[model samples]
Target: MTIKRITFLQELLGLFGLQERVHLAWISSAEAQKFVEVVTAFTEKIKSLGPNPLPAYRDAPRAALAAAAH
Candidate 1:
Protein backbone atom coordinates (compact mmCIF):
# COMPACT_ATOMS: atom_id res chain seq x y z
CA MET A 1 0.00 0.00 0.00
CA THR A 2 2.82 2.39 0.78
CA ILE A 3 4.55 1.58 -2.49
CA LYS A 4 1.31 2.06 -4.39
CA ARG A 5 1.03 5.58 -3.00
CA ILE A 6 4.60 6.35 -4.01
CA THR A 7 4.02 5.04 -7.54
CA PHE A 8 0.85 7.09 -7.84
CA LEU A 9 2.76 10.21 -6.86
CA GLN A 10 5.50 9.43 -9.37
CA GLU A 11 3.00 8.92 -12.18
CA LEU A 12 1.04 12.03 -11.29
CA LEU A 13 4.20 14.12 -11.25
CA GLY A 14 5.25 12.59 -14.55
CA LEU A 15 2.13 14.02 -16.14
CA PHE A 16 3.56 17.47 -15.37
CA GLY A 17 7.11 16.47 -16.45
CA LEU A 18 8.25 16.50 -12.82
CA GLN A 19 8.94 12.83 -12.08
CA GLU A 20 12.66 13.44 -11.80
CA ARG A 21 12.13 16.44 -9.58
CA VAL A 22 10.18 14.48 -6.97
CA HIS A 23 11.52 11.70 -4.80
CA LEU A 24 10.58 9.56 -1.81
CA ALA A 25 13.14 8.61 0.81
CA TRP A 26 13.12 6.79 4.12
CA ILE A 27 15.89 7.84 6.48
CA SER A 28 16.23 6.83 10.11
CA SER A 29 16.70 9.47 12.77
CA ALA A 30 20.16 8.09 13.41
CA GLU A 31 21.08 8.41 9.76
CA ALA A 32 21.55 12.15 9.67
CA GLN A 33 24.62 11.92 7.45
CA LYS A 34 22.76 9.78 4.98
CA PHE A 35 19.98 12.31 4.90
CA VAL A 36 22.44 15.11 4.17
CA GLU A 37 24.00 13.11 1.32
CA VAL A 38 20.63 12.36 -0.21
CA VAL A 39 19.59 15.99 0.01
CA THR A 40 22.87 17.21 -1.52
CA ALA A 41 22.62 14.76 -4.40
CA PHE A 42 19.02 15.63 -5.11
CA THR A 43 19.84 19.33 -4.98
CA GLU A 44 22.62 18.88 -7.54
CA LYS A 45 20.32 16.85 -9.74
CA ILE A 46 17.69 19.61 -9.70
CA LYS A 47 20.32 22.24 -10.41
CA SER A 48 21.47 20.37 -13.48
CA LEU A 49 17.90 20.05 -14.73
CA GLY A 50 17.62 23.86 -14.86
CA PRO A 51 14.33 25.73 -14.54
CA ASN A 52 10.88 24.18 -14.74
CA PRO A 53 9.24 24.39 -18.17
CA LEU A 54 5.65 24.21 -17.02
CA PRO A 55 3.49 27.21 -17.87
CA ALA A 56 2.84 29.63 -15.02
CA TYR A 57 -0.60 29.59 -13.40
CA ARG A 58 -0.65 33.39 -13.71
CA ASP A 59 -1.23 32.87 -17.43
CA ALA A 60 -4.66 31.32 -16.65
CA PRO A 61 -6.32 34.45 -15.27
CA ARG A 62 -8.98 34.20 -17.99
CA ALA A 63 -9.87 30.66 -16.95
CA ALA A 64 -9.88 31.55 -13.28
CA LEU A 65 -12.12 34.57 -13.89
CA ALA A 66 -14.51 32.43 -15.91
CA ALA A 67 -14.74 29.86 -13.11
CA ALA A 68 -15.28 32.56 -10.51
CA ALA A 69 -18.22 33.85 -12.52
CA HIS A 70 -20.16 30.64 -11.91
Candidate 2:
Protein backbone atom coordinates (compact mmCIF):
# COMPACT_ATOMS: atom_id res chain seq x y z
CA MET A 1 0.00 0.00 0.00
CA THR A 2 2.88 2.35 0.78
CA ILE A 3 4.53 1.63 -2.52
CA LYS A 4 1.29 2.27 -4.32
CA ARG A 5 0.83 5.56 -2.53
CA ILE A 6 4.31 6.82 -3.33
CA THR A 7 4.00 5.72 -6.92
CA PHE A 8 0.85 7.72 -7.17
CA LEU A 9 2.56 10.80 -5.75
CA GLN A 10 5.56 10.42 -8.03
CA GLU A 11 3.25 10.27 -11.00
CA LEU A 12 1.32 13.25 -9.77
CA LEU A 13 4.54 15.25 -9.42
CA GLY A 14 5.64 14.19 -12.88
CA LEU A 15 2.58 15.87 -14.29
CA PHE A 16 3.90 19.22 -13.12
CA GLY A 17 6.80 19.66 -15.58
CA LEU A 18 9.21 17.89 -13.22
CA GLN A 19 9.16 14.28 -14.26
CA GLU A 20 12.81 13.55 -13.57
CA ARG A 21 12.86 10.65 -11.14
CA VAL A 22 15.10 8.21 -9.35
CA HIS A 23 14.47 6.06 -6.31
CA LEU A 24 17.15 4.94 -3.90
CA ALA A 25 17.03 3.22 -0.55
CA TRP A 26 19.50 2.10 2.05
CA ILE A 27 19.41 0.18 5.30
CA SER A 28 20.83 2.12 8.22
CA SER A 29 22.82 -0.95 9.21
CA ALA A 30 24.89 -0.78 6.02
CA GLU A 31 28.37 0.64 5.61
CA ALA A 32 28.70 4.43 5.32
CA GLN A 33 31.23 4.58 2.49
CA LYS A 34 29.15 2.18 0.40
CA PHE A 35 26.29 4.59 0.70
CA VAL A 36 28.50 7.54 -0.22
CA GLU A 37 29.84 6.00 -3.43
CA VAL A 38 26.45 4.93 -4.72
CA VAL A 39 24.85 8.30 -4.02
CA THR A 40 27.86 10.09 -5.55
CA ALA A 41 27.39 8.22 -8.80
CA PHE A 42 23.67 8.89 -8.69
CA THR A 43 24.38 12.58 -8.27
CA GLU A 44 26.75 12.50 -11.24
CA LYS A 45 24.13 10.86 -13.41
CA ILE A 46 21.59 13.51 -12.44
CA LYS A 47 24.13 16.26 -13.12
CA SER A 48 24.81 14.90 -16.57
CA LEU A 49 21.16 14.97 -17.47
CA GLY A 50 20.93 18.64 -16.38
CA PRO A 51 17.13 18.48 -15.96
CA ASN A 52 13.95 16.57 -16.80
CA PRO A 53 14.19 14.07 -19.67
CA LEU A 54 10.44 13.48 -19.86
CA PRO A 55 9.53 17.02 -20.83
CA ALA A 56 6.82 15.56 -23.04
CA TYR A 57 5.50 13.43 -20.20
CA ARG A 58 4.95 16.58 -18.22
CA ASP A 59 2.78 17.91 -21.03
CA ALA A 60 0.74 14.71 -20.79
CA PRO A 61 0.42 15.38 -17.08
CA ARG A 62 1.58 12.17 -15.41
CA ALA A 63 -0.47 9.92 -17.64
CA ALA A 64 2.55 7.68 -18.16
CA LEU A 65 3.20 7.56 -14.47
CA ALA A 66 -0.42 6.69 -13.81
CA ALA A 67 -0.20 3.80 -16.24
CA ALA A 68 3.02 2.70 -14.63
CA ALA A 69 1.53 2.98 -11.17
CA HIS A 70 -1.18 0.55 -12.07
Candidate 3:
Protein backbone atom coordinates (compact mmCIF):
# COMPACT_ATOMS: atom_id res chain seq x y z
CA MET A 1 0.00 0.00 0.00
CA THR A 2 2.76 2.43 0.90
CA ILE A 3 4.68 1.48 -2.22
CA LYS A 4 1.65 2.08 -4.44
CA ARG A 5 0.97 5.52 -3.03
CA ILE A 6 4.57 6.61 -3.60
CA THR A 7 4.63 5.21 -7.12
CA PHE A 8 1.36 6.88 -8.04
CA LEU A 9 2.45 10.28 -6.77
CA GLN A 10 5.81 9.96 -8.50
CA GLU A 11 4.09 9.16 -11.77
CA LEU A 12 1.64 11.98 -11.30
CA LEU A 13 4.46 14.42 -10.63
CA GLY A 14 6.31 13.22 -13.69
CA LEU A 15 3.20 13.70 -15.81
CA PHE A 16 3.07 17.34 -14.72
CA GLY A 17 6.79 17.89 -15.37
CA LEU A 18 7.26 18.53 -11.67
CA GLN A 19 9.16 15.33 -10.92
CA GLU A 20 12.59 16.88 -11.46
CA ARG A 21 11.32 20.45 -11.35
CA VAL A 22 10.28 20.01 -7.72
CA HIS A 23 11.82 18.49 -4.60
CA LEU A 24 10.02 15.91 -2.47
CA ALA A 25 10.70 15.61 1.23
CA TRP A 26 9.31 13.35 3.94
CA ILE A 27 10.28 14.89 7.25
CA SER A 28 9.85 12.88 10.45
CA SER A 29 7.78 13.94 13.45
CA ALA A 30 10.93 15.09 15.22
CA GLU A 31 11.93 17.27 12.25
CA ALA A 32 9.25 19.90 12.33
CA GLN A 33 11.68 22.72 11.67
CA LYS A 34 13.18 20.91 8.70
CA PHE A 35 9.70 20.17 7.45
CA VAL A 36 8.75 23.82 7.59
CA GLU A 37 11.87 24.88 5.77
CA VAL A 38 11.49 22.32 2.99
CA VAL A 39 7.79 22.99 2.62
CA THR A 40 8.37 26.74 2.41
CA ALA A 41 10.96 26.29 -0.29
CA PHE A 42 8.76 23.86 -2.20
CA THR A 43 5.82 26.23 -2.15
CA GLU A 44 7.92 29.14 -3.37
CA LYS A 45 9.43 27.09 -6.16
CA ILE A 46 6.01 25.81 -7.25
CA LYS A 47 4.57 29.30 -7.11
CA SER A 48 7.26 30.46 -9.51
CA LEU A 49 6.48 27.57 -11.85
CA GLY A 50 2.97 28.88 -12.56
CA PRO A 51 0.32 26.21 -13.28
CA ASN A 52 0.01 22.46 -12.96
CA PRO A 53 -0.17 20.24 -16.07
CA LEU A 54 -1.85 17.10 -14.76
CA PRO A 55 -5.20 18.56 -13.89
CA ALA A 56 -6.89 16.03 -16.13
CA TYR A 57 -6.79 13.43 -13.36
CA ARG A 58 -9.92 15.04 -11.99
CA ASP A 59 -11.70 14.35 -15.28
CA ALA A 60 -11.76 10.66 -14.44
CA PRO A 61 -13.51 11.22 -11.15
CA ARG A 62 -12.74 8.27 -8.83
CA ALA A 63 -9.61 7.35 -10.73
CA ALA A 64 -7.43 7.83 -7.71
CA LEU A 65 -10.02 6.48 -5.34
CA ALA A 66 -10.30 3.38 -7.48
CA ALA A 67 -6.58 2.96 -7.65
CA ALA A 68 -6.26 3.10 -3.89
CA ALA A 69 -9.25 0.85 -3.34
CA HIS A 70 -7.26 -1.96 -4.83
Q: lDDT per model, in order?
A: 0.81, 0.67, 0.72
* Top-TM-score candidate index: 1
Where model 1 places Cα greater than 4 Å from the true spot, the runs are 55-70
lDDT of 1 by residue, 1-52 (tens): 7778888998999886788887778899999999999999999999998876
lDDT of 3 by residue, 1-70 (tens): 6666776777888864676554556789999999999988888888887767456466755765576573
Please provide TM-scores, in order, for all candidate models, with all chains considered together: 0.65, 0.42, 0.47
What lDDT score is found at residue 33 in candidate 1? 99
lDDT of 2 by residue, 1-70 (tens): 7667766777887786344455445536467887887788878877876866566566876767787673
User: Lowest-scoring 10 consecutive residues by lDDT in candidate 1?
Assistant: 52-61
The TM-score, computed over Cα atoms with residue i paired to residue i, of candidate 1 is: 0.65
Comparing 2 and 3 on lDDT, the stronger one: 3
In order, how many clashes per candidate?
Answer: 0, 0, 0
